[model samples]
Target: MSGTVTLGMVPVVLTALFFVLADGQITNDFLIAHLLAMGVPVIGPAAIWYWDARVFPTFVDQSADLAANPTAVQRVGDKYKAIFSTRSWYFVVPWIALIVGLTVLNLGFFETVGITGAGDPAFWVYLLFAAWWGLITGIGLHGAVTAVRAIRAVGELDLQIDPLHPDGLGGLSMIGHLAIWTTMLISLGSLALPLAFLLGTEGGYRAVVYLAVGVYIVVIAVSFVYPTVYVNRRAGEIQERELEKRREKIRQLQTQAANLEEADGDTGTIDEVATRLEIQRLRDEFNEYDSVSLYPLSVGIIIRLVSSLFLPIFFTLIDIYLGQLL
Candidate 1:
């Protein structure tokens, strides 16, 4: 039998068309709400696409050969510094302006338009905070996490560039781990605001709205974080295996040199020297970060586990509340 149509693109398209058709008659308020609702699914795909296509590819697995004396780590930092100071500012400034503008307009709508009544102060308060938290949680977390991932990628590249530099490898690994933990803390903190709002709601429609919002938060968070942790662990394992192979090669070179030193012709001596050099390079690269190391695979696995464990409950709760919202 042919595969079932599990995808919902058709429905989405229909719904989108319906909204477009309703544009002339629907009030601006309802139109904006519908547009936002439609745009929600686009967010995940957009983030993932940008990260994989633009962000991750650019930074992940970045490396440099030792022939370039000073190494690539410093360049990575410089690249990020430029990004934050300029291109990042372009994206961020507009978001700040939009948020501030929307907030002011929303407040004015409530006050001058007299849409929100005095009797339901709680409802207004809930709406304001929810909207504020939603925007902050999305933009702040994305920017912060992107910065960290870029930094980590650069640090990893640094280690690969100069495996012999003691300070180079170890320092980068430490900094990368620090960035991961910091990212996690910030992410968790961002979620707390929405989660708290859900808890404080009077256990009805409003509560459901908060709950749906929270679920969306958890889904996106776990999706990104879990994959990262999995990839990290896998990378670490691969690194370990490569390290062993390099060590064996080094041993072989040492044995060859010992056997040929006394009776060997120049050709043997030259071959042994070449092998020794290659082994030395591998050893230096493999052991670059002696003091600090992280398994990318393990990190990826941990994040995946956390995501899987949390997502179901997160989604279920959100679904339950979302039903109420509708």
Candidate 2:
């Protein structure tokens, strides 16, 4: 992981160094823009990989373990295989298509803005960088999908679900620790370099910022939330089954107690008393289910996760407005 990150950042660091070295000696707009373009793919993937290292350690660890032991065909292992297999076409195809589409759009935008001449080296450089950015973005997205799959695998594990536990999802609370929202935030942050370049020069391109933010919202929804839908549904099913079993037991106790009372014409008999106590115990057990959540996250945690997603957009708007003011 460290090696991948270091290697990925080499181009970006070199580009930055070049700009600094020529800071006062050169004033060519196309040259500087081309250098910045060269930095995009380099910085983007490195930032994404570093963020994943910090926020999604479980996914990283699992991936490493699977890579080390490819023959381990356990539940989680099989799912990991499926994630990287032909099923991954769903993610890969769309990613490539979007990249090609976006590259064309970007080229058209440059032409419309009169920023590129027909034979300009910067134009071709920008095209190359756009394609590179698309590839890196696709790689990051594939990682996100893998992380989601890892989260789902957690639910399939033989975890104990204790109704009395604080998290309400047994020890499966780690499912919430997936840091999905954090990952999404980091992914957005990786685009900061290119976004900064665009926003700095193109005053009329505020729409582009909004479009990026909107697309990020969709990505977050699909990557972070969509993958967990199955986990939530499975949890609910488990909760229902457990509750029904307990409820049936309680009902049986109640019926037995009533029969005892009818036979003796008295409610104070020992058998009736024992049956009542058992029913009370069963009811308490049944009520314990009330505390268990269908999903691993609490309301507070969910609110935090959601808030983190929008904070970037909020800050971006502020930056744009502040830029206008200045």
Candidate 3:
């Protein structure tokens, strides 16, 4: 993530240096815009990578416990390796295409905005800035994609479901937490800075900014939530199977108690009492299933996800409304 962000910033920094040497003065707005563009893409991925790095040891430890065999351990390592590896062309290609398309669109936008003048060095510089922006943004997006793929890969892991486990999902709860962090990384890294740039700009582009915000909300919501769906489904299935097993046990015990009651009188009373105790134990087991969440997302994660989407818009609105007042 750091390497990708650094590569993206090199062009802008070099361009800014060249312009400073040649023209002696660069427009403050242009500098600010380019810096924001470059910085926006870096923030989300950097934060996520930092988090991954910090928690990685814990992940490895948990993975080792889950992956009892050497093959499973190797697979777990491969999945982690894939998170940072650029070996996946399927992931890299779309980002490259997006960069190309956005570069063209931004060039046209600069031209339309009168920032691109014929044969002007400044215009070319601005175009380069746009391209750099797209490149970094693409890299950030690629990281997000990698994170999602990692989560999906986890779903394929041969995991043991221990019904007695405290987390209720057989210690696979880490997967859900990882999903939340990855979603946050994508949200803040990919969307926040660009939207900040758009909202900060002047003109009749408020409508454009709002439109972008709408798209950001929808995309982030999906990206954040979708990675957890498969895992959530798996958890639900496990919970259901466990519940069914307990229910079956309860039914058998009840049937035995009913038969004992119909058979005799005094001898059946002790048997019925023992059967009732067993039935109560099974019922407690069934009730414990309620403690197990099919969807691993907690209320806090949902709040954080919502906040990630709304906080930017909230501040943008403040800036807009307050700017009008001033």
Candidate 4:
């Protein structure tokens, strides 16, 4: 996990550092414009983390003790389900930044570069960041889908209380950890893209930067999110099937329990049959729910990271080539 994060972030940190140092040398309005342009990409993910740390976490105390409480578990589960249901505030921030950032760019640079329009450098830059925002949002959407599927699957599982299975706590930890890291890496990488261009653009590169972001967003939204939605849909179907199995087990248990009580301890045969039936029924119910394990989380998390990583690498390389053109 540490290795995945380090490998993912090294390029971003290096890129940001390079951009920050190079920002000092750029003095022309066009060049300064490029530096400012780089910042647009960072807005959404940074805003997300800030909001989560400061605001979102306030709503739920996710401690182990809290989880142990049945009421807390239900409430927290509902809270998370609701949280992931809507398009997060993170998605809106990019558009806000784009409009606000471009407006400022327009007012300040319009006279020199002209207002954003066809074949205009500023227009292309705006488009680039817009694309980047879309790509990032799509990746985030995919991650959310993956996480939801994982959460639902785990929620369905009838974790054992025995010492041997340990209630499958290890599986839960693994899924949670995967989601957390994938979320962080994707966010960081999104920020690094524009930052790279800000420090490196020669001149007249803003449009190309925007163009790069724009193209990436199109590809990701079309390819990654759409298919992720399908996979998540299938996962939901599987979860539903497991839920039905549990319900059926519950029905069977209730019927047997009723028949045993009706016998009223008359014959030893009936008592023995009742006792054996109860044990089997209970075990069957437990196993029925236990089958809804963490497999979806594991698979979805892996897919999310793989796709998320692919987008950033593609954008970085494409943006580099675009910068060269400028």
Best by TM-score: 3
| Residue range 303-324, candidate 4, lDDT tens digits | 6656665656665675556556
lDDT of 2 by residue, 7-70 (tens): 5665565444534533233334434444544554666665565645554555434333323232
TM-score of each: 0.40, 0.64, 0.69, 0.35
Sort by lDDT, best first: 3, 2, 4, 1
RMSD values, in order shown: 15.0, 6.6, 5.1, 15.1
Total colliding residue pairs, candidate 4: 10
Native-referenced Cα lDDT, model 1: 0.44
**TM-score of predicted structure 2:** 0.64
Shift of residue 69 alpha carbon in model 1, Å: 5.8
Q: Model 3, which residues run further than 4 Å from truth? A: 1-12, 15-31, 41-45, 51-80, 88-90, 93-97, 100-132, 156-172, 190-213, 257-276, 311-326
Sort by TM-score, best first: what order? 3, 2, 1, 4
The models' CA-based lDDT, in order, is 0.44, 0.57, 0.59, 0.46
Question: Which residue pairs in candidate 4 collide?
Answer: 124-207, 125-206, 125-207, 127-210, 128-210, 128-211, 129-210, 131-213, 131-214, 132-213
- Residue by residue across 201-287, what tens digits does model 1's lDDT show? 422345554565566456545544544554455445545666777677778877876776654688877877786788678677666
Cα error, residue 263 of model 3, in Å, equals 7.8
